[model samples]
Target chain A: MSVPFYDSGVASGLLSGILFGYVLEAAGFGSARKLTGQFSLKDWSVFKVMFTAVLVAAVGLYLLRLGGMIAGNSVYIPTLYLWAMAAGGLLIGAGFAMGGYCPGTSLVGIVSGRVDAVVFVVGMIVGTMAFAGVYEPIQGFYFAAKGPDAQRLPDLLGLPEWLILAVLIVVAIAGFVLGSRLERARGGPFTAEDVNGEDTSKAKNQNTTFNTEAGIVP
Target chain B: MTSSPRPFWPPLVAGAALGIALLISFLITGHGLGASGFVTRLSAQISGWLAPDLTTANAYFGPFLTAGAPLASWITWEVIGVLIGGYVGARTAGRSRLMVERGPQASVGQRFAFAFIGGALVGIGGRLARGCTSGLGLSGGATLAVAGFVFLAGFFIAGFVVSALVRRAWQ
Candidate 1:
């Protein structure tokens, strides 16, 4: 077959989603503890996983393009909607921290039997409906910045595309280093005792030593 | 816990593999990657089913309805892939368990509330941002889109700030 494979929409997405979910779970993204730990600066698997994936793809795709293999850019490059994106970023970030799963990861969680992840999916759906429902009122501002221009860092800042990409690569590497330092400083990854998946505050209240020997500290 | 909680793959290994997934995604569909778009359309479909007029009347949902049906999308299939793949991953790793993830200091109900609200926020944010982490951060960032960076900055800023207050959720 060709370098660019056939794109049967549903078939494509289904296979892609399966791969996506599998990779996520393998990376430990299915666990809220590992994911949420990023925010607390306790464990950095989240940063590590995200940064590594992004960097690898960014560099790989660029290389493929240079070789004239992959052809043009992705099917869709999200346009710049500054106000809307900024607002969305805040809510999404907060949700990720609080809910402990982004949309992709949440699906992974659901399959892994995490009830909270399922709940989150439900909440996100309701929230989406709410947004769609209220779109009538917010349309003016919601799409105020919407346009056809595809904004790239090079074009926006007048920098060479290669230079920007190089910088991003450098930044991702630096982030990995920082992630390692933060992980260590946080006194190693949280054991089951620290986040036993239930209210173990009672045990903490007793100030008793956590007996991991039995494997059921509570 | 059995086997002291099986360890997950190192980030470098798993992430690079994931990047390959992105590469395949591009090769197959010419699209980078995304998840929230599926949920958004699904939500609209539901809304359309119950209140077709109102859904079609709203500028946001209306435009989407014009494009045939929201039920059919590349995102839906990919998300299905995510579900099956996740099951495989969790099953192989021995990490599949039905439970609500929260800190020892919190309760199930508290976690549920937090989950719902946080999910709602992501729902709102996903639409505004035009994509979620995988969509914006991974796919968009890989493409070097300027808005991708902006969304990334905002997401991390909000996440860091909120994480401080909600430390009990994971700490």
Candidate 2:
């Protein structure tokens, strides 16, 4: 009883990435301004899309595993490296605030024809090289924690996966419910330019002209 | 351009679809989804190609070179597809436009600098954590991985904390 074809490694990576990319674009993450706005009290599309995707996947995986459809242990989980992951997370987060795009969003941004996104991609490559050059010094801390590799939240908390997942779903629902309102309060429906405090009438005009030219009814 | 906020897939629907896709990945590959691993592998390969002796000498690069997929991996292929799919989705949705997006107050040059710096940080961070948002936050969270939880917690805190300092960039 194997699960499905699209679930495997390389194949699923391709499928999931494509789907994820589509989802990201649909959420308007290709626009750096839209993404950065999540940090602002302005718009929260990033939170909305990200949490939605996470909760949906969390519940889905929980149910499938509970149903005996897939072996939970078979799922790939990285070995725990506390210091490395923490430091990396902080660095990456700082980068997010500065750059406004994750690896995933940068790809989508580049696809959507954003020049900044392209520069971001090049930066990623350079960063990788920089890290590699200094890999020797960092490797020790990076591989420091060789804890029980069978680490999972449920296992760590000594709770059932189903129960933990259920709680997560509830939290996601609440967040979404609250987030929508917060977004509206911040700025109901402003363009990236507007949210950034730029004169957005030009963007509005461009939108109207494009819509009229393309015969799009909106 | 319609000025109307484009409709997004409902959160629940989008989540479920993403979940199913992740589930499918687990079922087929005996593992879940990932993004950073490819970058790590690529980085390793690039290092090896650039300086075989140095790559081989490093303990980190040793196992990956021997144990992992070849340079032309499925993950690499999938990333390529992600690029294509992203392009298609953006174009169809009228979201495809060539522009440097930044906070209105942020200069194009400043934003570009941040974009590069942020990207570099992500590259290193993903490798250090053994995953990125896609790998740790999404797939690992789905699978209930402890590392995933830790990574997510760390990332959110860092993002929010730094967000304040960079306020001028966004608005």
TM-score of 2: 0.86
C-alpha displacement of A72 in model 2, angstroms? 3.7
lDDT of 1 at B43: 87
A1-218 per-residue lDDT for model 1 (tens digits)? 45667585778888878778888888888877778888888787777777777778777777887887866654457788888888888889999989988999999888878899989999999999888767777876777776447777777889976798788778778877888888777774544333332344554555476655535423
Once fitted onto the true fold, the runs of candidate 1 whose alpha carbons sit more than 4 angstroms away are A1-3, A73-75, A146-148, A190-218, B1-5, B63-68
| Candidate closest to the true structure, highest lDDT | 1
Question: Residues B1-171, candidate 1, lDDT per residue (tens digit)?
Answer: 333345677888988989889878877887677999989888888888989998888777787787889878778778878888889877766677667777678899999999999999999999878898989988887777877888888888999999998987765
Judged by TM-score, which candidate is best?
Answer: 1
Docking class of 2: medium
Residue B116 in model 2: shift from native, Å?
1.4
Q: Individual DockQ of the candidates?
A: 0.67, 0.57
